[model samples]
Every structure is written in C-alpha cells, then in structure tokens.
Target: MAIYKLDTGWRADYSYYDSFGKRKKKSKRGFKTKRQASEWLTEVIKDINKIKNPYYDWNFVDYFDMNMELKINSGIKSETVNAWQAVRNYIVVKYFSNIKISELTREKYQHFLNEYSIGHTANTVKKRHQILNSVIQQAFHDGIISIDPTYNVRITGTKESKDASEKFLEADELMNLIEHFSQEERLSGNSSLSSFMIVLIAYSGMRAGEALALTKNDINLDHQTISITKTKGRDGINTTPKTKNSVRTIKMPSDFFEIYKLFISHKSEWNKNYELFDGRKIATNPNRTLERYEQKNNFNNIVSIHGLRHSHASYLLSKGINIAYISKRLGHANISITQSIYVHLLNEQAITEEQKTIEMLNGIK
Candidate 1:
C-alpha cells in the first residue's frame, strides 16, 4: 500500500493477492490529506483480510441478489419479497449494478439517492433507501465492506408529502358513507358486495386486503367479532396477514352483525373457503368505487379504499378511543406505528383534552 501526493490531493493505492492467488490492484484518489488516504487504505486492507474469499468480486447487485434469497428463505412475505425485487430491478440496478461492494463510498451512495429522490415522494424515497440499506448493512456484517455507505445519509425527495386530511373522512362524513352503503346493500337485497365491503372496512378498520380475505367462517355472529388472519394480495392471491400482530379478532357492532347475518343469509352456498367479496367483483382499482360514491353523494372529501381504514382510525381517535387499543384493532405491529400515522388526529384530541383540563381547574377556583 502507498499514499502519494497529487497536484491537488492525495491518493492511496494497494496491491494484493486474492484467495485464488491471483494478483489485483485497487486505488482511491482525491483525498484532501495524506492521513485520509492512509486511513482509507488501512480500512480497505482490513476488509480484504476479513473476507474468507477475497477472490470473489461481488458487486452491489450481487449482494442484493444474495440478500433477497436469504430473505425469501427466511420466510419473508411474498409481497415484501416482490417489493424488494422491484427496487433492485428499477432503482438499485439502474444506478449501482456494476459498482463493487468495496468501491461504494458514502458520496457515491448519496449521489444515487439524490437522483432517485428527484421525482419521488419523501416516503417513497425513504422506503427504497431502507431496502437498499438493508442489503448494504448485510454486506458490512459479512466482511464484504468496511463501512455502511448508507450511514448518516440525508434522505430527500422533491415531491410534496401528501396532506393527512385528504387521506381520511371526518366522523360525520364517514357515518354518512356507511349509512349510504348500508342502504344500498339493503335495497339491492345484499347483492352489492362492493357496498358491503365499504361498510365493513369503515366499521372494522380492516385493510381492504384483510376485509377481502375474510370468509364466512371468519365472522362470528354470536360473538359479534370478526377474525383477521389473512389478506388478499394485489395479485388476487390469499396470503397471511402483513404481520403476526395482524392476526387478531376484533369486536364489531351488534347492529353491523345483524346486517352481516342478512347479507350472509342471501349466500347460503358459500363454503368455508369462499371469500367475502367475489373474486370476479374485486376491482383492479378499488379507488374507483370510492370515487363513484363520492360523486353520487356529492361528497367534498374523496378518499381511496385504504382511506376508509384511515377514516375508521380517525373516527375512533376522535371519540377518545385508547390509541393502544386502536393500534391493535387496526392490526398495526405496534402502537408507535399507529401514533406516527395518526399523530395529527392525536394532536387535535390532545388540544381538546387540554381545554377540558383548564376549564375544570378554573371551576375549582
């Protein structure tokens, strides 16, 4: 290894023999100081020695593939595995396909993230970064690299974050929506499965996929509860819930169960495996159904099917429901996840309670 001074900066160069006894050379340049170059070269040498087979030249893409295989073998959900594959194909490969794991620097990784954030939302960019960072972290742990390129990297995106209000309906609006759907189901003699689904999601706070995956056996009329054990993926295939916490039983309104009994009575032929919504009737874009309802009712706030889940949580929060209970009811992995998503609603509730506390204190005087 050698550090040499250049016209503007210093450079570190190294030569070594691989595990196969083949000679190879690597170098990095443009460091401001000789010490910086020496330190980097030392890290590289240490990393090389740590690897059992330094002969294997694995690129970032190669590490990503291995990470994906490990994740699959570890029993990650198919949807999650598919998402990681998409990130690899569309983002990671597009930028870092040829970059060797040892060659990845913080600056280079930051540049790739800056490019990716150009037309994406902050959340979208953050999620993609997390996926890539996981693979890079594994490479570091496996002694393929000395440092995590993702560490302390600032994540930014040009696209504006979505407004929270637009993601859910207020209590009155949600009640009106449910009432409208309920009337539609009754008038149609329980034939409108979409309308029924909208009502179920609004009341139960179940994700659209979880609601769709429900079977006749999952509903308990006597107990006034519904079991959430699985979800329907975007591919129309049934799979386990998103997390272990998602496998839960939640209470439903007795009146809602009455409507359910009426609805189920019309479907006597449905077997235990038969899904709540007919596969043929499940729209590729569920938001279209919400749009139709909004137009018919002249609703000012338009929300997607997933928005009904948000609306459900918002409604419960507005009514002073315990957030921890709400988290479990919504099948969130933890209360923190629920709090982050509905922090705005929680803030509003906090203000109301603060006012009540001040008023009670004043009355004591």
Candidate 2:
C-alpha cells in the first residue's frame, strides 16, 4: 500500500493477488490528505480481501445492509426508507439470512417466491419482489453476483389485488361522527380537541401528517382558514409538505371553526408555536378516541383517522363540485390523482345522470 501526495490531492494505491493468482491493483483519488487516503484505501483493501477469500462467505443479507447505508446517507425520505426496512427485515429474518450470496441459485430464489406467495397478496408480494430485484440487479451490475436471480421472475396478481379502492366517509357517516363526537367530546374535556380535528380533517381533506403537524399559528379562527405548510412524515418527524401542491389554505365552516376556538380558550393553549393540542396527548393516535366513539355509538364502518380526509373528498364529489377545486382542497399534486382515486364515485355520478336521461326520454314518449 502507498499514498502519493499530488498537486490536487492524495492518491491511495493497493495491490493484491487475485483468486486466479493474477496480480490485481486498485487505487482511489481525491483524498484530501495522506492519512485520509491511507485509511480509505485500507478499508477498500480489507473489503476486497473479504470478497475474494475462500473462507469469507458473504451473504445477500449483509450486502443489503451496506446498500441501505448508502440510501440512508443520501437523505432519502424516512418513510420510504422505513418501508424498505420492513422488506429488508422480512428477507433477512424470514429467508436467505444464512444463505451465501454467491450460492443463491435461481431454483432457490423461485422456491422462496413460492413461500412468499403463500401469505401475501399479489400486490404485496410484487412490492417485496420489486425491492429484492433492485438489490439483486445492483449486485449483478457491481460484479458481485454472476447472474440476477429475479431475471425471469414473473409476478401473478391475486383477486385481493383487485379489491375496490379505499373506503371513505359518506355524508351521513360524517354527520353521525360529528354529532356523536360533539356530544361525547363535550363530556370528556380531551375529546373536544380530537372532535375538532375530526371535523377539520373531514371537511378540509388534510392528510394525517398535515393534521399532526398543525401549529397554533397555522389556524386563523377568525378567517376560518387553516394553512397547511408542513406535515409529519412516517418517521414522526415534521417536515415541509411532500409535494408542492400539499401547501394549501383550507377554509373551514363556521361551526367547525367555532369548535377550534372553544378548544383554544385557555391562555396556556393559545401558544403561537405550540401544537393546537399543546398539553394533550390524546390527539397522538386519535384511534383510541375513535374507538371510544365507536364503542359508544356502535358505528357500522370503521373509518380510520385518515379516512376522514377521504370522506371529505367523496362528500364533495357527490355534490358535483369541480374536480379542480377538490384537487386543490385535497392538496393533490395533480387532478389526475384525484380522478384516479375517485373514479368509482365518478362512475356512480354517471349512472345517476343516465337514470335522469332515461326518465326524460320516457316522459317524452
């Protein structure tokens, strides 16, 4: 090993014998100092040694960890990283943890896919498959693997994959939720805060992340508008809205705005930078609050907190409102996304119009 000082920076060089007894040389440039170059080169040499030594059997599980390290270092969205992490855990713990990467045969990978198909839906399996394929393809490109195991893998979808789009709140359901909660929330002082949040979320179509990241100053009770400039990520960290369209101003109804005013009555709760529900942790999950509402009222559908946003959108669509206005209200990046999710509802509207056209024709006849 040697480190050479140059006009621009230092260069590190290391040489070793390949598995075939051929001399192999490797070098890296742009290191700031001799010490830095030496250290980086030393690590590279050690890694190369590990890759070639007959006794050192590297597995895909460990390789994936190193691959993920690069992803984390590159400042990827925490939510996306978290999703890949679940896939990584499933791979490492469920299968292939002990199998050597070089020993991974196409037959063995096919067997693993068969096992994976037993439990997960087709869409679910496909997601995991996509992640694995990416890593395996990378390994192949890096010359670490002889062939890509998933090269010919085909994904077959299931009936579960074709399940109808998400469930949303109907007008009746929203009203029931609000009425039930308005009474129940008044009974429990903590309920009032979550109650307002439910109404705001249902009416405004704000994401759970945007709702959680709501600050006291973001709300204008007098103007009946709430500004959505930031959102909470899956990692529970507050960050700017994921998309530019996510930053929006949503107008609230008078009664709904009044609910917010009533909750912030106390001087301690009126903090500018503090969260709307500053002292209360009940708003953390809101599921418990919803559970309480369900238990007390015995509701038919189990709508999630996020479903309120869906409900709000569906409710607006039923009124024959402009899709563009709804898109902006929902803070969707484009109207196409709104149309895609609400296509079923749009079909229902078409059916209603068809019925009217048939009636008009019948009356003329």
Candidate 3:
C-alpha cells in the first residue's frame, strides 16, 4: 500500500504481482485525510479476503441492513428499531438505494439531503439526518468507508418549535372535563371508563404509555402514589419508561383513588390488567371523546390528552411551586426541562412578584 497527498486531498495506491511477475495495481483518490486513505486501504484489504461476502462491495442499503441486524440483536427498544427501519426504508427506497457506501461522497450526500428535503419539514429532515448519520458512522467504524458522507452536510427542512405547547386545560377546565368523563362512564354502564385513564394521567402526570402499562397492583390507594415501572410503546409493546426518572412513583391526588377503584372493578374476569378503557384492547382514545365534550360545553381551551401533563405542570408553576419538585413529579430527568417548558409562565410570575414588591415598597415610602 502507498499513500500520497494531492492538492485535492489524499490518494492511495496498492499493488500485487502475479506468478508470471506481472504487476496489478489499483489506486483511488479524493480522500479528505491521510488517515482516511489508510482506513480505505484497510477496507480494501478486508474486501480482498472476503471474495464471496454479499456485503463485500455493498451499497449503503446493504450496509444499513447488516448494521441494523446487529442493532436489533443488541437489545434496544423495539420501537427504536422500528424507527430506524423507517428511516432506512425512506432513504434507501427514495434516493440512496444504488449508491455504494464505499463510493458515497460528502458532495453526493449533500445533494441527497437537498433532494430528499424537498417536501419534508425541517424536523423530519433532522430526524432522518440523525438516523443516516448513525448508519454511515457505523460503516466507517467497520472500515468500509474512509469519510462519513453525512459529515458537514447543512440541515434543511422546516424545524419545529422547541417551545412548550400552550394547548392545555386550566384547572377549572380539567375539572369540567372530569365531570364530562364521569357522564360518559355512567351512560355506557360498562366498567371500562375512558375518563379513568385521563384522570389518572392528568393528576398523576404519568405519560399515556406509562398509565397504560399500569396494572391493578401498581396503584396504592392508601399511599396515594402510582408506580411507573414501565411504559407501553406506540405499538402496544411493554417497555421501560422514557428515562430512569420516568420510572419513579408519582403521587396521586386523593380524588384519583376512588376512580382507580371503580375502574379496577371493571376489568374482565380473565384479564390481568384494565387494558380495555374505551371498549378496546388498548387503553384510551381521548380525541373523539374530548372533541364531543368541547363542542357541547363551549370550552375554548381544549387540549390533547397528552396536554394534560403540560397543563398539570403549568398549573403548578402558576401557583409558585418549586421547579425541581415539578420536574421530578413529571419524571423529567432534571429541573432544566421543567424550567424551559414553563419559562413563559415563570416570566408572568416574575411580573406579578415584581408588582407585589413595588406595592410593598410604596407602603414603606
């Protein structure tokens, strides 16, 4: 193997002699660094050893399939594996199916990004970039590529806002929603109550998946705290919570105990858990039910069911509660997440507190 620097970047050359003493040489150029050139040489040597390997001269799609198999067998969440598969399908089928990973270039990848981003949102592009970057990095790690094609590529796509959503119910509005839920539960006469799930999540700040993962024994009426050991994925598979913090117990309001008891009584005789809240195998579907309530009650601030957790945090923040406490209660890994989300509400509190201070100073004057 021989390496040389060129005005373009770096080049690598290799040679082998036949029995007849004839020289057979191969050379490749356009590597960004001498180290990259060396890495490519290593990949070439490995490919020469594995003449019959399917992935020996594979494209990005082939490499992606190989790496993803390892990723799946390595025991990541199935949902995460599914998401990665989705990214692979979108990229391979749409644009990069034929491009060999060894031949993939930064310029070509930039072009791919530009073309792939045409109709997608910035957030969508960002997510795809994350997955693609990982896939390409894996190829580089395996010495299949010298440079990561995804490197230095500018992101394109309409990015979503980082601000916390304001579409959540006020405290009084939540109570009104609970009342509506009660009505629905009574009229159905089936013990399966959609409102129970909502009320459980709203007051306890458990995620939709976390609440769905709860069993009858997970609730402690005497202690007024619900344990959140696991969470269900969107695919209805049981998995660990979002983070270690999310796996902690959440203290429930006293009002939640009776609701829990009532719902637990409704579980099918043969079933282990109350997974039939809306008369289905899954837990709850709040959209249609809440939509009807909002129309009939003339409620203006109708929040999504997930919005209940936001509303809970917003309400507590509005009441001058500690941010760290709120963060832990919501199972956020740290207080900063809570602070970022409720910054707008916190700013309002500052204004109110400042006004109160001025009023007190005026009395002193």
Candidate 4:
C-alpha cells in the first residue's frame, strides 16, 4: 500500500506489488481534511486497479500526477528555474507547499503581488510577477494545474521610458566633468585611463557595456578603427548589437590612437598579475570605475556611466555633425528614434544657422 499527499491537503493511500511479487504499502503525508484525503483516495484507487490495463499510458499523464520537484526538472534553464525555486522557498514553504496545483488560484497570486508592493519597486514587482506567471504557465502546460493562476493578476507599475532612464551631461557640463575626471585620474597615477574611456564612449557613441567589454585585441590603432562585436541586451545574451546596423565599425580619432596604445601598454604591464585584465580578456565592470570617479569628483548632475553615451550623441549635435551620421555612430536601432529625441536640439541649432543666413543676406543687400 502506497499513500501520497496532494497539495490540496489530500492523502492518497495505495498497495502495490514489487518486482519480486512482494506486496508493499507506501503512505504519502500532508493531508489537512477528510474531503481532500477522500479525493486522493479515489484517484489512487483508479491507478492501482488499472495496473493490469496494458494501455495505461502513465507517461502520457501530465506532471500533476507526479511531484512539483520532478515537474520543475522538466524543461526550463537552471537560472530561470531558480527563480521559481526562490518563490517556492518563500511562499510554498511559508504557507502551503503541499497545496493542490488546481486549488492555487489567481486570488493567491494577487495577494502575493499586494504584499510585494510594500517593499519592492514596480520594476522589481514586475520581475517577481513574471517569475510567478512563468511557473504557473509551465504547471498548466504540464497538466499539473487545471488553470494558470497568474493570468488575471495585474502588475501595478508604470513602465519607465528608455530616454527617461538617462540623464546626459550638456556640453559645458561634460567639459567640466572631463577636467575633473582627468585631474583625479592624474593624482591616482592612471592619468590617461579614465579620460581614454570617456573619449571612447563620447566619440564612438558605444554603449557602456560594449565599451567595458572591449579588450586590446578589439582595437586597431594602425587602422584607426574599433570593432564592436557584442552588446549587452535583455536576458544577458552576449550576441550581436541591438540591430544589424549596429555591427558597423567606428573610425577612431587619429590622435587618440596613440593614446589608446599608451593605455594598452600600461594595462598589459598590470595584466601580468591579474589574469582577467590581461589585455586579452574583456575589461571588467567599467561603470564601477566611473562611479568611483564620480564620487571623487562630485559633479552636480549625478549620472551613470551609460549617460556618457547620451552625452556623446548630444555632443555630436553640438559639433554640427549631421543627424544621419550621429544616428549611425550611435548604433540606433531606428533613425526615427534618434531624430525624434534629438530633433528639438537640432532645430535650436538650425535657428542659429537661419539667423546667420539672414545677417549675411542683409549685409549683401
């Protein structure tokens, strides 16, 4: 006899014959009510009585027939699966790990979401909601649950705009920042390092991650160009750029090539001790370096290392660089996105040009 417990506080008791024809009784635990126990009893009896049926096809049954732990082992990646494991550790162990898959409803998910609001930001809440929804969907697909519980639960959070996430330094502010950054770097015995990174992002318009991921091999000082092969995207995949257009090479500053060479030589010398920073492997967490620099310098407008990318694009506009060139240099997925965000600044520059034309025409008359 084998007895198993279902999540709905039900016990399934049964007896089975072993391979050697020995009778065995196994009892599964975790029953809270007689009705729940009776439900499992009925289901178990059917399985036990049908053992002689040749076409039983137990494998065809969904994961509900098995255990939650076994079903989680089925098809998702370890990282993704770990998210559900955390939820299980938090909710299931705290409340009811043995609750029936069919009984866990949307109301329960809503409650979890409501409780989550007090401590988590909307983005964090959304991520947790997504993790829960994924688990529910998997369970439904695997036949563990009759319905997906997370479908109706709403995440109460507004999505932040891509542009809103950034706060770029204006031209004068950027110059001041560079002056401060350079002075701090000089005092630290790494005079050119921080300035070179700033120049690379500002001039090339590369994402902070792609810039940080750079190694000495990725640069071509002789050719005066940089090959950007990878970009950080959602899911943390180290694949191609955001768009196909982003794969193009960037022309380096003619004078800056020598500076890059000098920086590489210094990094290479230090690489003898640290394997990761050996000029061959990717540069590690450049933003942390930027953060320390920002803290030391204490600029009024606090911004992330990523904001340097935006500042670069903004600087290009200020330099009278064509919009198309700026768009391509920034590796914008769409020209429309670049134009829409930067058109107002371009228009302001256009007003100055219009005034110059008027003055020239008036002088000629």
Estimate, for each residue in 342-362, the C-alpha lDDT of model 3 and write its tens digit.
888888899999999999999
| C-alpha-based local distance difference test score of model 2 | 0.75
Can you write out model 4's per-residue Cα lDDT over 1-365, one digit (the tens) per residue? 34444666656566766446788675555788766666777676545534633223332122223434564567544344456666556654554454545456778767767776665567777876665565567666755444577775777644443443246767776776555543434423544455566656756778755664465667776788988876543333345665778777888777556555545555535543222123322323445566666667765445666778777788888888888888888788878989887776778899999999999999994
| Residue clash pairs of candidate 1 | none
C-alpha lDDT (0 to 100) for residue 10 of candidate 4: 54
Instruction: Report every candidate's CA lDDT.
Output: 0.82, 0.75, 0.73, 0.61
- Residue ranges of candidate 1 with Cα displaced over 4 Å: 1-56, 184-191, 235-239, 265-272, 279-283, 295-298
Could you tell me every candidate's TM-score relative to the true structure? 0.79, 0.74, 0.77, 0.57
Q: What is the lDDT for 267 in model 1?
A: 61
lDDT of model 1 at position 157: 92
Query: What 10-residue stretch in candidate 3 is worst by lDDT?
Result: 274-283
Q: Which ranges in model 2 have alpha carbons more than 4 Å from their true place?
A: 1-57, 156-166, 266-272, 277-284, 295-298, 357-365
What does candidate 2's lDDT look like per residue over 204-248, in tens digits?
Answer: 788877887788788886788999998766666667887899999
Candidate closer to the true structure by TM-score (higher is better), 3 or 4: 3
In candidate 2, where is summed lDDT lowest over 10 consecutive residues? 157-166
Backbone collision tally, model 1: 0
Q: After superposition, how far is residue 36 of candidate 2 from its true place, in Å?
A: 47
Best by TM-score: 1
TM-score of decoy 1: 0.79
Ranked by TM-score from best down, the candidates are: 1, 3, 2, 4
The true-versus-predicted C-alpha distance at residue 114 of model 3, in Å, is 3.7
